[model samples]
Target: MANPGGGTVCNGKLHNHKKQSNGLQSRNCTKNGIVKEAQQNGKTHFYDKLIVESFEEAPLHVMVFTYMGYGIGTLFGYLRDFLRNWGIEKCNAAVERKEQRDFVPLYQDFENFYTRNLYMRIRDNWNRPICSAPGPLFDVMERVSDDYNWTFRFTGRVIKDVINMGSYNFLGLAAKYDESMRTIKDVLEVYGTGVSSTRHEMGTLDKHKELEDLVAKFLNVEAAMVFGMGFATNSMNIPALVGKGCLILSDELNHTSLVLGARLSGATIRIFKHNNTQSLEKLLRDAVIYGQPRTRRAWKKILILVEGVYSMEGSIVHLPQIIALKKKYKAYLYMDEAHSIGAVGPTGRGVTEFFGLDPHEVDVLMGTFTKSFGAAGGYIAGRKVREGPLVSV
Candidate 1:
């Protein structure tokens, strides 16, 4: 290429015009420190690059792609700046729209879920809400939005749900068909779901005694007695059996029912390490030595209380070691088989059966049927050293 005045000649042509990706040209400008713009007043001029001088300098596709990329970059940059000023750059309408598409509408599909649920909540006293309020705020609702979380219209759903953790049905009795239910139904028909009175105060019905008989048969014991609940069985019997002056050696791992009952007995309570024969013997030996010298009062009726199975750890007690220790120290023993009754031992006689020990080895065997049998009461099975124990079960 040559300049017009024959000043020089070169293969490359000098471009007279330069264009930006936007197809806008830069105003007449400088290239190599040559002045491109003149100042006017106090303002400086900035000009955009526009159309290029030569189209043959680059391939058509390459040129078009570069221009398109530049145009798109400018467009997005403007949009971003615009949105940032409006404080909406971070919000995505597309994302919110996608989320809205995935919801289960509360009103459209789940009706009657309203009244039954609200009534049930009030009936159950779930939150312990106030009972004295005027009714039907729903009569004035144009739409639903509350001054608080929920409007006065409906006692809005406050709590999500209740999970059943304390049902305590260990044997899954509720799920069984045929035999257990049939037995329960037959028994219920004969003796009502519950007795109308207490045992000492006319609460004890014939069915109550019958159940006790059934329990004794189950535990293979001479006698058994039932209480309204598993907790009551121990609560009442413990104080009656052990007087205020007696010494009771209890295991540290014994249940709260045993703890409360023993406390109520007003007995001298001594606790040994859980299931440790050595620990129990130490206490028993002390009682025997101290009880005799201090008073000639039958040398203290020493009662040893323990659980047949530890519920938390699912550990079984060594009945042989305990029974042997009881005999060695002339102590009467009580065993609570709450978690063991129907699970341990060969014939389901609990720890006694598990150890090949006779039922007579335990002075009193107490436990609940709400666990293994899937039924709802607790019983104490025992044999008398002097008189034969009678069972109403």
Candidate 2:
């Protein structure tokens, strides 16, 4: 028998563990592993069956200290800059030539100040060079920075067996697999690294076709299109889907790639609160009633952009509710499952499968192979579109 939240019921009563600092609560049977539960909308969701976790904010003290630190840093940074400009100290970044000084700055003052003063101080913690594949355990090189993380040099020492806590190797596919490595080598011998042309100009290969077919089959969709780069899958294709006179309702915390794509699409973009159905509904209602601004003409199309699992927040999308809302407002839905694909769901088919929702309900299903598959590229899947009269129904 199973508990109401879908955990296995033990003969003994479940014992509650102390609450975690990150706001996770667990109840476990004596024999089984810890099972975390989150309560929302009067429903208990167990993480044992679903990988999604409730969004938790940092503790008040943590936020307070973080802001204080930044404020102090900014204050000192401005003071130093002021001193340099007033000749009290040397201005190391000052340009020496008139032509160079007159040339338009590559970055705005705020951006340049941020990189030089703020980011440079804490850059040591980011972009560490790894010596091994990003598996469960890997090696990272040791380095030292003499100028407060502005530059670093190797110390000829390695931190081996370091736990890789950050990489998106969700299924451990980054580790060497015998058959997969052999197949990859075989394909490399034939494909020769990369095609020197775009798909339309001769880049298309038999493997591309095979991969698209497999993606479509796996997604249970009518057809699929493959792209070489995952970021391009969103940044490039969004423009093809909608343009000026169209309206895009996007989550406020969506990935930067999606934001870029929406801007490039020339669509009127309105951001709704992240994972908030009420906010989304309000936006949709306003869009319908107002129509296009000034002209008051109906929009050519309306697209709702959301992610299956938001990468940074680790909060799963409320798909069922969003689908219902999409239908209510007659809006097309585009789901980016970049982080959720192969990491969630009963069979790892992604959020659609996780929620037992029909794939056809979503107009566009976009995902990347880089995360769980430990591979490169991305795909877009949806109902098959015929060239002419016979579009898939």
Candidate 3:
């Protein structure tokens, strides 16, 4: 049934109801037969609060919204699924038509094997929904299935109120603590979720400047630049800082973002053993002595990149020793404190504070707000300013 305003009424409930121009309202009936609406607006008022409240009341199932528009998005989604199924069917048909001895090995074989044997197995056992916000303790839906199938169902049974040992909520700031939630609520009411523009454009809010200043004060740095994403903070800015004719000494076990940024910098890259100052020193000395490859000319700059904490190994960087080597070699140091910023040190000032070294000793201090601050995005801090291309979202 269609309403007078072009909204659809399904199962005695109104759906796709639009109160404002160019907006969508998707309603779902809760388990208790209460109809709740989820709204999607272009710039503001995304999702109604009642939809979230409905989820809190009945956590077993979720309603998927069917959005209508130009149909391009829906078409693409169906096209992707169709192509994927077609490829699988074609592969299976080819295997059946040919003998095992006559089969030609392809890269798809490895991908298929890994997808079926490894990824599916791990995903089936581990992937589940966390009922509560991230903190030291929360609720998670425990996977009840042991099989590796494409479609799997979760049991209504929830491992309620379990100690959260998996997430990176370092300072236990998540779980909507009273003070944080109050501040967040006020901000949301004023800002309406996001600025909807890039920092270089009209998106630069007073809060952005204030947060940057606060981060600089906390890290004891001269200036800081905040990015929209933690991963982009490293991946995008590294290319701006160093380019061709520079030498990059990176830790072997550095994060992939750092690796990508270093590669994009178009500099000579060398990897040292993880957290090994001796190996770093050796690489630094060799680079300083040999200079750039083929050209044999002195490098414009030498950048030593390491992380505050190795996320995979859970080992903190040897900052003091690394700083000493950087000073000796006249190399600039870039420290990624994504994991250590709010988790390490006496007061959570990161690895520099934990090692009793001055933050100024490190040339560039980079960290993410996702961990301890219970927020998104990242920041880059430095003593001097270097102009680079600004990324617009």
TM-score of each: 0.55, 0.82, 0.68
- Please give, for residues 100-170, the per-residue lDDT of candidate 3 as tens digits: 54676654543454454335545744556888888777887765553334556778778888776677677
lDDT of 1 by residue, 18-98 (tens): 234444334454532322332333322322222122323688899899889767655655575468549986422112245
Cα lDDT, model 3, residue 97 = 42
lDDT of 3 at 231: 95
Ranking by TM-score: 2, 3, 1
Q: Candidate 2: where is the Cα deviation over 4 Å?
A: 1-53, 83-100, 386-393
Q: After superposition, how far is residue 357 of candidate 1 from its true place, in Å?
A: 1.1
How close to the true structure is residue 152 of candidate 2, measured as C-alpha lDDT?
A: 84
Q: What ranking emerges by lDDT with the best candidate at the front? A: 2, 3, 1
lDDT of each: 0.63, 0.79, 0.71
